[model samples]
Target chain A: MIELVLSFLKLGAVSYGGGWTIVGLIRTEVLRQGWLDEGAFRDLVAIAQVTPGPVALNAATLVGHKVGGLAGSALATLSVVTVPILASLALGALISRLGPRGNRFREALRSGTFGLLAMTVWAFAPEAARDPFAAGLALGAFGLAAFTKANPVLLILGAGALKLLASFVLA
Target chain B: MQASKPPSPLRLFLFFARISAVTLGGGYVLVPVIARGLERKGWMEEKDFFSLFGAAQSLPGPIGLNAALFAGRALAGLPGLFASALGVLVPPFAAILLVSEAIGVVAAQKQARAFLDGAFAVVPGLVAALLWRMIRTRAWNPGRVVLALAAAAAMILAPGWAPAFFFAAAALGWFVETPGTKA
Candidate 1:
């Protein structure tokens, strides 16, 4: 149980992005740690998304169970979640006084945001490249978004549906 | 690192809780809201704000939670981290708890029925749009264009083939776009 929690803590401790990057990180850790194989890990990712809870929580629980059953699941979950929750509260307190106009702080925030954007690009790169359709769909979707002020949700649904239609119609 | 005198723990807690409850959408969506909230109050300069955001992206955990931690640590050091963490978590925890308790009661409701049906209907479209946006802003490789299409084919043809299709797409992007380098 302790090991399970600690491993999850390790994941939280080292990751560079949110749910997105965590996917890659989790893949590396789970495979390296011998917690699960590629097949099982893939399945878990799907289930994690479909499940109602947060993706991280589902992942932690699954990893924990593989490592040490119910107890492991509980520990991993707590460890993964604890640090960030605390940090956000402290931030809230800080912000109440600083305001956005503070120049230095604002610069830091902008740089940080830029860095995040870059990282997100890094994170999504691999997924975007492997499949031609996904690539085109994403590009078209992006073009639509960039060019028009359309609702994002509509774009996503349309892409999925359009692809399905294309597959059958073209086939 | 110099630790500032601890701020009131309660103040820290309430502040984050309010942010969490009011924030719609995900972490990215919360960025502008948080920035405005802090900027208006004068607690952090824009540079510091961006820096924290960058750091948050690089950190493990949810972006929202990461923001809380960065803000807390900036405000009051170690103790602040603790306060913010609890505050951010309380809302989701309370919400989940409430939903779990009421799950049985709402299991047969008409509103619930409509919500489930309506929400699912739009999910694929939303995914498509988000996937598009993600590609446009982040995955702008010509090679990625090819992979995404292939993956989509694999997914539709072989139901439940594997999410590896997606990750594989990402990994392939790094290779195809930049030879001998993995993203």
Candidate 2:
């Protein structure tokens, strides 16, 4: 339990950019530590996405539960959030103190986020490419999301429904 | 109609909880959804909200959760912060717990597995769309674009050095100013 909390704490502290980047980081650490196998990790990722909240947090909760039940879930969730919450508080204070100059710092961070997100998308590409049907769905979803103002929740549901239909046909 | 009195901590908590519960695409997409809700409620002005948002982006953690913390702090102080954080976090915790418990049964069904695969596959596209939107909306420059592409390439070529990539990007960003902005 302590190890689980400590591992997630490290992840929460170091993870930047976005959830996908965090997911990548979590995947690496979990796999390295023999916490979860590749297949289990993929399922966790999928479950994290379909459910609400940050992928990292969901992953932590799920992984923690798997490892140590309810107590682990609480510990993991708390550990994952502690640094972020503290950082947010500190940053919030600093921003107010810095005033307009803070905008520059914020912009820099935003740039970093963009870069990280781009890397994350790149990392995810191979997994996405593994299945042709999934790839097609991904592209179509991208088009829909990019061009239209469709709700992502609706799009996710639609994707699930489409997949179910596809499975029936294939079966 | 704006309430003459500030919202109670419970109200703040519930509001954030609702937002977190319904939000699908994760933290990046939470901004607009939050802004819209806060605006509708007259809880925050546009300028204040964006500034908070900018700060949230600059901070660590999930942007959505960070935003909630900031907003909650702004709205009602420490109590509000606790309330909002709990509100935003609870639903996801419950949902993930429920799903994890049921995954044993769910994974066994081939159709369910396919459905999940299909849904998970679109995640990359959704992220791509987000990237495209970010580029389109932000003031872009040659240097920033190059850095982004380089970062992507680095991740592809050397997955092991992923952590270094983030640090390097931030370092690059610190030096690279936004286009048309004076140093």
Candidate 3:
């Protein structure tokens, strides 16, 4: 239990970029602790996605609920967000010395964010591409999302429907 | 939209709560909704809200949550900040908690399982798309390119200590981007 809080606290501290990067961090840590298996973890991530809110926050809440019930849910949710809230309070104003350096600093973080995001992609790829159909769905999603302004929720739902239909026909 | 008088914390809370409840796609999607809603309500202009967003990004945490915290503060100080946090957080937690129980029943269906598998499959592609956009938008020189590749390699190799590598990369970015700040 203590380990759970400690890990989230640490995870929250460096969860730069956005929800996906944070999700990768949580997935790695949760798996490391043996709290859940990969298939289970992937299911949780799916649930996290369609549900409202930040995916990482939802992931934390769900993982917490799975491991330790309601109390765990609350603690993990709050714990994961603790540093971000504090950082917002403490440093939100500081960003706007608004000088040239401020903008440059944001630029500076981009390389690392890019790296973190790269790692996130690396982590998710093989698992997402394990089967040819799955690979096709993922590639199609990439093309649609990258090239057009298609909504993600629709993409996810559409992918799910396609798979359900495929199962009916294939089976 | 003209700037109105400061909204009450409850108003801020309820406002964010509505956005939190309705917005489906997560932070990147949610943040824009908040921006627009705030603008429509005359709470903060889009430009000011986005400037705060820029600051919020530098800090850790999800962009939507951080944006809420900053926007709340900008609009109504500490009370607004806390209210916005609770607003953004509470609905989702409650909703998930309720869904968590129901998910078991839903997961039992074979069709549902197939659907979930397919939904989950596109996650990597979505993530890759996001990275592609990030890469495209950022100002990158050859030095930054080498640095980014190195950082990505190091993080992939040692993800457990990824934060350290990321911060190190950030410092290196500062060094490389800021020509002649090496006094």
Candidate 4:
């Protein structure tokens, strides 16, 4: 239990990017520590996404529970999440002080963020764009969201139906 | 250093907790929510919101996680950090626990399965829509577009390359801009 909490604490403390980044952090930590094999870690990510709640939270809970039961879940979650919270706050405060200097450090951070964001999306694009019909649905959904303020959920349902129809027609 | 008094920690926590609890969509969506919330409270201004959005997205984790931590830390020091983090998390955590307990009731039924089939099917599109919004944001530029394309190509070509590619890109950006390198 102690180890589980400690692991999550470290994972949470350092895993700064987001849910996706947390996966990598967890992979490194867990695999290095022999906590879970790669296959199991992958399975955990899948299960975490489909199950509900925050993916990161779910990941932490599963890891903790597996190693230390309910108590482990609590500690793991706290460690993983709280660390980032403090870290973000600290970073934000630091950025505030730099205060509109247009310094290279700040500019670089901004540009890097844009690049990272774009790259992150780019990484997912192909698979996400794989189904032509799904792609159209995504565009239409984006349009609805951008223009009509339609509930995103509705567009999603519409897209799934489109996919189902495609399976029959295209197949 | 301009010494302005920081806001109360408890109030900041409550403010963020409300934001987290009410947010329907996940992390990215919280960007707008926090922006609006912070603006209304006078905790941060518009420029601050945009910069924070960029920094938060760039840094790596969930936007809400970063936002909560940033907002909390801004309002107070360590105590503010704890409050903000806890505030954003507790509501969602509690809600999930309740839902997860009830999730079993719907897990096996035919009707439930049918409902979930539809729900799961829509997920891919939902994911795409979310990605599109993030992609089309103002931060996007030609260099980013190329990086994105390459990243996508790499991910598709080798499904296992996500972490390496992402970190490598970040490292590239970091090192390329390192102060000494620029000079």
- Show model 1 residue runs off by greater than 4 Å: A1-16, A20-79, A82-171, B1-9, B139-183
- On TM-score, the leading prediction is 3
Task: State chain A's TM-score for model 4.
Answer: 0.55
Interface RMSD of each: 11.4, 2.8, 2.7, 6.1
Tens digits of per-residue lDDT, candidate 2, A1-171, equal: 778988888777755554555676676667777888877776777778778887778889988988888888888888888888888766667776665566566566565556556665775667866878878988988999899998776777788789889989987
User: Comparing candidate 1 with candidate 3, which one achieves the higher lDDT?
Assistant: 3
Name the 10 consecutive residues with the lowest summed lDDT in model 1 chain A: A106-115
lDDT per residue as tens, model 1, B95-150: 43344345446535554432322222332223344444545564234554555556
Give the per-residue lDDT digits (tens) of candidate 4, residues B1-183. Answer: 233456688887788778767664456556677788777777777677676565554343566777666656656777887787777777666655554445547545544433334333333344444445645553544654565566546644553444455545555545444343320
Each candidate's DockQ: 0.09, 0.56, 0.65, 0.21
lDDT of 4 at A74: 75
TM-score per candidate: 0.51, 0.88, 0.95, 0.64
Off by over 4 Å in 2: A14-17, A96-100, B1-3, B40-42, B178-183
The C-alpha lDDT values of all candidates are: 0.51, 0.76, 0.86, 0.55
Model 4: DockQ vs. true structure: 0.21
| Candidate with best DockQ | 3
Q: Rank candidates by DockQ, best first.
A: 3, 2, 4, 1
Give the winner by DockQ: 2 or 3.
3
Task: Output the lDDT of residue B37, model 3.
Answer: 93
User: Lowest summed-lDDT stretch of 10 residues in model 4 chain B?
Assistant: B113-122
Which candidate, 2 or 3, would have the higher TM-score against the true structure?
3
